[model samples]
Target: MPTKSLTHPVRTRASRGDIAVLYTVHLDTSHPTTGCDVSPAAVHEEYVVTRVTSVAADGAVTSVQDTRWSYDNSSRSLQDIPGVAKIFVIPQDRVDVEAALATAGAHTYPDTTVLRPYATMDEVCDAINPHRH
Candidate 1:
């Protein structure tokens, strides 16, 4: 994942060059490592946003911009979305967009990227790289 710190431009509003996060409620994964598991291991699966998109748009999403800060690992990889790219025309429904969004996390750094509420780097490292070993 990218830094948990907000870059301001990363607000959830799907704008050009903005990293839009898609919340996956439960994604079955075949992670390369056993310690990489994100499953709940019990009730509901974990809610996570792995991939992010830096969209390009005029009035609405038009393309995926190749942003340098968009990735650091597999989970933070940028997705190439053809449907919303400038090459294809998709209808915009502002009302639906408004209805679908719920802003979370505190904005910091600048209005360059919005970091969603997630575990801090130290917390994450502690979880994945447990001391039990």
Candidate 2:
């Protein structure tokens, strides 16, 4: 699978009525591996960004910029989302994403639709790389 980090501009609206410019990105494994026996799809290493701005806009997000640091042996990418200046690692797998999102409870914007949160790298790795040992 080709691992890539996509950085996007962000605009954070803080609880303290503050707005900040930030850059964010989401780490994704285009082709996820799956099986049973050994630990599958685990991130052995990665090149990532650390620092970012809050400029999450409805614009097109392409490329990686405004970096800080990257986690070694990590498949997760550091994203800079709007409204927040914190670093977060997310899973791009559908199963992992859906499972993690269950914590959000319910979604109000989409009305009948429910929104979920991001998934941890471990969970994503396990799902993708089942076990083939």
Tell me, by TM-score, which candidate is best: 1
lDDT of 2 at 109: 32
> What's model 2's TM-score?
0.19
lDDT of 2 by residue, 2-42 (tens): 53222322222221111111222332356465564233344
Q: The CA-based lDDT of model 1 is what?
A: 0.29
Q: For candidate 1, write residues 107-127 as lDDT tens digits.
A: 223665654322243332222
At residue 75, what lDDT does model 1 achieve? 25
- Model 2 / residue 92 / CA error / Å: 2.2
Mark the 10 consecutive residues where model 2 has the least summed lDDT: 14-23
For candidate 1, give the lDDT of residue 13: 38
